[model samples]
Target: MAAMIGGAKPADAGAIAALNRAAFGGEDEVGIVERLRGDGLVAVELVAEQGGAIIGHILLSWLPTIMDGRAMKALALAQMAVQPGHQKQGIGGGLIAAALDQARAVGAEAVIVLGHPDYYPRFGFSAALAGNLASPFSGEAFMALELVPGALAGRQGSVSYPAAFGL
Candidate 1:
């Protein structure tokens, strides 16, 4: 499949919400994503398109953390979803890569994701807990990646994602 990864356009909102609902097994995530977009908190919102149709979506939002008494921009990878028929076809991966690239381009210090450990680690994610970072929920599902050398150095604190996450 030939897929193009690009930033979300205004026209893509409905399609993106549909993909999110289908991929996440509900509509709750759709609202959260929309809210994030409206609030200008989405650092990067990427979509995977094939043949002029959107098949996958991913969102990275501004998650702030106070470490060493300083506030820093922490990229929060959330709501990654590929259409049911498009799963395992690399659309999800493409979306993630695009989002990460955008984050790096903008000089984000670190990225955090609450996702499947097996899948995210392939993209350089590691257990945030090991680095003294904690989430509202406990487990290896919460992970982090430092985008710059020593970006996470001496940083130890809890992550605070947007309230829309309900966490």
Candidate 2:
């Protein structure tokens, strides 16, 4: 069966929240998403649907990072989740790929994600510490991928996600 991937509409509010809760095992991330949405920092929220049911979701938000004494627009990939029944079917991968494409279309230089090292590497993410980037939590969980040529070249700094992320 083919899955349909697209940006989430306002009408998808409940489905998005439910996807998050199932993915992360709680409502905390759902609240963070709601806050980001209300604060106008959500660049894009994507959902994957199969058989008329939402099964996956991903969120991209503005993350400010300084490189060479200048600030640049960075995208933070967060809240990626797939419904329990849909796990390991590439739904999450499709959602992430779509979100990254959207980010690139908007001219975001780089993208950062806090996720499993093994999983994100497939998407071209590597240890951000090599580029002098670190997250509020730790260096290991932070990863980055340059979407444009030399986007991460000479970039170094702490990443600041939207305040709604509570990072």
Candidate 3:
């Protein structure tokens, strides 16, 4: 409740990386984010700020998807992290909402994510929606949301994540 979600600035990179390290207890996420930027795959990057400090971060990147033999415009909710001290305070949800809004604003038709099934569904992410899409990740953890109505309907094919994900 104390944090406001907004787009991340270049100057906030170090803080974002540090927050990712603390949230995930490792450097893998941080590396993925950096590589996303370097590869020009970044679609949206949002941060949660409270008292002028970055408390959370979320990144969405271009996801290469082929559906029904045609390419579709999609974004991937690549990584999201809330500072350990800031978890469970609704910051993560806020980031997801805001990031999705931004993704839509940027003309993305759909968004996919590999995340907790229980959590992402509240925002309309569904493994069933991603069911026909092939990816390195599958099962309930791999989900998708159609920002534009019926975007994923009757579509079938594979999704390729940016090389940064190493998946």
Number of the predicted model whose lDDT against the real structure is largest: 3
Off by over 4 Å in 3: none
Candidate 3, 1-167: lDDT as tens digits: 48988888999999999999999999899999999999989989999999989999999999998888878899999899999977898999999999998999999999999999999999999999999998898999999999989888865778988789976
Task: Please list the C-alpha lDDT of all candidates, in the order they appear.
Answer: 0.82, 0.83, 0.91
lDDT of 2 by residue, 1-167 (tens): 87899989999999889888888899889998999899988877899999999999999888887777778788888779999989999998899889999998888988888889889889888775325765575655678888876667775676776689875
User: Which model, 1 or 3, shows the larger TM-score?
Assistant: 3
Error of 2 at 131 (Å): 4.3
Between candidates 1 and 2, name the one with more favorable lDDT. Answer: 2
Per-residue lDDT over 16-64 for candidate 1, one digit per residue giving the tens place of the 0 to 100 score? 9888888888878998898888788898888889999999888899987
lDDT, residue 94, model 1: 80
lDDT of 1 at 86: 87
Score every model by TM-score: 0.93, 0.94, 0.97
